[model samples]
Target: MKKLFLSCLFLLFFAVAQAVPAKSFYFTTSDSVKLYVRIAGEGKPCLFVHGGPGSWPKIYYALGGDVTEQDMTMIYLDQRGSGRSGGDDKTDYSLNRMVKDFEELREHLGYSKWLVMAHSFGGTQATEYAYQHPASINGVILVASTLHLKSSLESYIVEGARILNKPESEFRKEGASVGETLGKVVSQLNEQDLMYKVMYPKKEMFAQMNAVMDTTLNWHFGSKVWDLHEYEQDFTQKSASVKVPVLVVAGKYDYSVGPQHYRLFKFPKATYKTMATGHCPYQEQPEEFGKYVRKFVARLN
Candidate 1:
């Protein structure tokens, strides 16, 4: 009985020792709102901004892994009103406030310069952040992002709905509507139903979609009144004036924000590429995405 108890204690100790806890930190925004951040790896800082103004930082874990292997420090931040962040005042959820949050986080981290890797909506935030603070950015990697929310969301919905065999009338009616109503209709979709059936046709896509759906639902509910029009106006103006070493990456099957949207952006110096995958190309093809990011950053050096 003594020997068995000792053995059980040893097994428990080994299990606890092997467990890797995700590192967490906090940065206070200019408005005194506390923002949460997670960091991994070491070397030049590569701040990763997630899509959905309300998205959690965990979505970038796969990309962070790639950055880590390349000796790059990965910074994942949940924007205000997002995962583990403080913003009880929903009014604090504007795009300008979000931009300030990034600036404050950078100041708190004590980084004079850093690279940025952002996805979908995160890409938009990254671009705006770079534009406002050009000297603070070393370079930028934009993955499946767009300047205009209307065009991007419309294209995504239409393409996804068509792929899912959703009725054209339902899409058309939703398209004519505005704001939270449109988003609500899109959010309540069953993962294995029409949208997933069409947008995610492959087995691997189904797996990825399942993961994305959970976080996405949380974000959609948390930020139900996201002002897309204001977001679009601000991004379009900022994107045209950016002069950083920008790499715009899109997935070939990304109905979310098609390549056409990237073409509309007036970046002063931008290199664009489309991967042979869908929206979350980093997960679908991490090696390729990492290779591209490494090559792009090298060019800046």
Candidate 2:
């Protein structure tokens, strides 16, 4: 009886979801990897590149991330081997290939150009995408991005160690890789139940993040991206060569990517802001985020 009732509820939910006037579908990349993409809203087109290397765009969009939709068409793409997306048999996750996927999607959609907004680790991919395919993008927006993962990992050791009341030297590198050191320190913070301190302001709100992100998703990009030598380059240095107009948002309390890391960026036509929130200023401080985003986007139109 209860099983039947639950099944009915699930069907009803699916029915309602289908009823909504939403557009979502899958696209096959040149490498034969299938990826999921959802297009909605109006005005200028803007692609959203999510973080976690493997993270999906759903949580952010679920958490009122659609605020930018008012001013632009939102293209929420789940990167290959990510949320609701299929993987490549060749196991290719190269930076150039990733950017090529974005370009191919643009050409597939028949768009001359679009804007791109990247978050956290996705910023690495977005930065590369903008540099290699500037002709296909009108502008780029980076939120709480880490151009240098090494810098971000060190931040986790320092800030997370401080929160756990552990000495940073305990996790310091002794010929170990930066990625390994980061894993050790971040594990400590998560074990102590102090991860919120490393990325959020409070436990309750942080719980909301976990509630939306579940274990059923694929995490291939996050699992393999760190070891990729191509991503290890200091994208901040390359920032100076990127001519795309940029909007950069940094957090005052975001130790995950280093709160003040934006200082290292050198995008020539960039507008910068430092929010009092943590790594997720878009969710924590949406109005302020929307204001600058809308203003910047308006200028592009």
Least lDDT summed over 10 consecutive residues: which range in candidate 2?
A: 14-23
* Per-residue lDDT over 222-266 for candidate 1, one digit per residue giving the tens place of the 0 to 100 score: 454354455666375677788888888887777667656777877
Tens-place lDDT digits, model 2, residues 85-122 = 88743568888888889999999999999999999988
**lDDT: which candidate is best?**
2
Q: What is the lDDT of candidate 2?
A: 0.86
lDDT comparing candidate 1 with the true structure: 0.70
The parts of candidate 2 lying over 4 Å away from their true place are 1-20
- The global C-alpha lDDT for each of the candidates, from Candidate 1 onward, is 0.70, 0.86
Model 1 residue runs over 4 Å out of place are 1-22, 62-69, 178-192, 197-203, 212-225
The estimated TM-scores of all candidates read: 0.81, 0.91
RMSD of each: 6.6, 7.5
- Residue 292, model 1: Cα distance from true site in angstroms: 0.3
